[model samples]
Target: MVLAIAGIFIVFCSVILIAVSDRHPDATEGISSVPISIISPFQDAVTGSITFITGIWRHYFYLVSTAKENDELKKMLSQAVEKKNQCIEIELSNQRLRKFLDFQKTRMAQTVSAEVIGKDPSPWSKTVIIDKGRSDGIRKGCPVVVPDGITGQVVSVSTYYSKVLLIIDRNSAVDALVQRSRARGIIRGMSAEDCTFHYVLRKNDIRVGDEVISSGIDGVYPKGLRIGYVSGVIRRNSGIFQEVDVTPHVDFEKLEEVIVFITPAEYEFEMP
Candidate 1:
């Protein structure tokens, strides 16, 4: 009975030792897989979340830098545009000055430059004030001209300023002749932009685009100075004279500078 009891105890201990020992490879692997399965997903999730957050932060900074650079480029563009405009203005001013100088050199008469400073307040009188007066050799009846054509004549004078009566004033008249036919007529201003060529004989040949020039008979304007061009002509059977409409060469509204021909005392006295 004693031997049987000892044998049963030995068997029980052997079974416990097998259960506790890591003897079988498959068994060991199975035991280790449970913790790995549970922990691997958590590690992957943590790594993924970290990567996502880092990517978002990097993109936000990139956007901010791009926007700042765009604003800087826009400011540079605005500055370049302003500079270009200034350059264009300077070029235009230079061109005008060159033209004025060329005109001065070509003319035979002595002239002084004058700037337009003001306009006549009276609606009926089409006149402009110049920056020259008696001090600058400007006097009454002095002819004012531009590169295009005659503009006006000085009507009043002061110490430092002079008033010019534009040829378009109603009270203004000029002796002119048609360059094509040498037809003589009196150009009378009826409005600010309109003039009538009166006393032109109906038999005289008058056509549109015919250049009208000073006849030098008035003793005011020089001979052959451009006055206007014939725009229209009207002939009537009952009237002895033909009516001709003329368009002036000078644009009074755009006048900025003028050349005043300084007439001698004899010429000024001869003018009526």
Candidate 2:
């Protein structure tokens, strides 16, 4: 009974549609009994509506996914950059600590620690000023050294400031000995990168890479402090001495801080 009722309802709606189409013949122009032209338009409208709604949903989903990916990538890049800077800072601190330990082991006679606060700022002068001054027991002719070796001498001093004449200065001289061979010579500041060792007997045993250190005989610099490594040796033709060039241990271009050995007050000079 239910099927019979539904079939009757469908047939009744179809008849009404056919009567309406008959009243408007253009709506059924190509069909003989049914309005196919009207049927086509309705079917096309339903499909187009579905496609428009699906396109809108697809665009919305794409926008949301792209925003999330962009944020994630930016955060990753930020973390990488931060780690790079941290690594560089750690490496620099490690190098400084190693230098400090080396100085402690040497136990220089007596020492003053100071930071370089200023430079000549002129290409003509390689001078640097240290924070330690005369008030801090610093004076002219005081020896200065870094972990690797000698830097210069304190040439001028005020109550609150001291000027260091770098090993590259023209007027600086130091008595030094070759570490491996125990040969003695007078080293003078010759240039920005090295010094000249004079009064070396041509027959003396010297070679490249020999370490140079303070001789302590002058009572100015304590003996056995490193100065530089030998880089050049020139034998003169029938001359009394040979010329030697040494590369300083400390790099002035990268100089930062230094230690000065101050002899105990009782450590006075003995006249010959």
Candidate 3:
């Protein structure tokens, strides 16, 4: 009812204003002034409503545009971070390869470089799988070494991969000599980080910090290649041999790339 009355009032006011204006062309005086004053307030309210609705519509679209732009910027930033990480990895790999090249130039034996791909899951056995296999001249009993020192020996071979028994495994052994006093001993794997130097006479002048190297008497590792250093020594009063602990030069946890000697079993070459 209120809406109908308001519509009727608007029509009535329009007709009166038109009729009054037509009667007196040049007169703005008596009747025309009353109707104009009555309708002015409603006109202003309608104009204000239209303006408010238009402002809300424009602001909604602007917020949507800003959200889309923010999403695109986030995506671009993620891609940039991924590319930077890849570049860093490539540089590190190149550095390791350079070190391998220097090692090959200084060594006398023929060797094939292989990447470590997998590790033995059994905690009792310290072994790692390499990318090289029988096709790459990697055979059982092939010695594996890194730039620092001996790593292990290849014990199992497949077409494209081989499993190496690391020097830390209990079954591994190498003939070693103390670099300082020429004390002869057999280095046997005792644990993940240490080995035992066996058969060293108690009378020998061996002490902690003495460097150990391969003797090449066993015909496996080359002569004078660095193995480890003596970390501890225990002498018994009655026993002729002393108990010695050795720490290998190679860090097995950080092992990545290794060199496998392809030379025959009897042809062990010396390292400079």
Please provide, for model 3 over 148-184, each residue's C-alpha lDDT reduced to its tens digit, 9 standing for 90 to 100. 9988888766666677888888878999999999999
| Estimated TM-score for each candidate | 0.58, 0.57, 0.58
lDDT of 2 by residue, 1-272 (tens): 99999999999999988898657634543342133223333434554576578778877768879788889989998998999899999878865775655532223267899877666757766777776766789866788889988888876665555678887776678988999988899988865678899898988999999999989786677777889999999987989899999988888987867997655223333222
User: How many backbone clashes does every candidate have?
Assistant: 0, 0, 0
Residue 68, model 2: lDDT of 86
Candidate 3 lDDT score at position 149: 93
Q: Which residue runs does candidate 3 get wrong by more than 4 Å? A: 1-107, 264-272
For TM-score, candidate 2 versus 3, the one ahead is 3
lDDT against the true structure, each candidate: 0.79, 0.76, 0.80
Q: What's the CA RMSD for each of the models? A: 43.8, 40.0, 38.1
- Please report, as a residue range, the 10-residue window in candidate 1 with the lowest summed lDDT: 263-272
Q: Could you tell me how far off, in angstroms, the CA of residue 78 lies in candidate 1 after the best superposition?
A: 34
lDDT score of residue 201 within candidate 2? 90
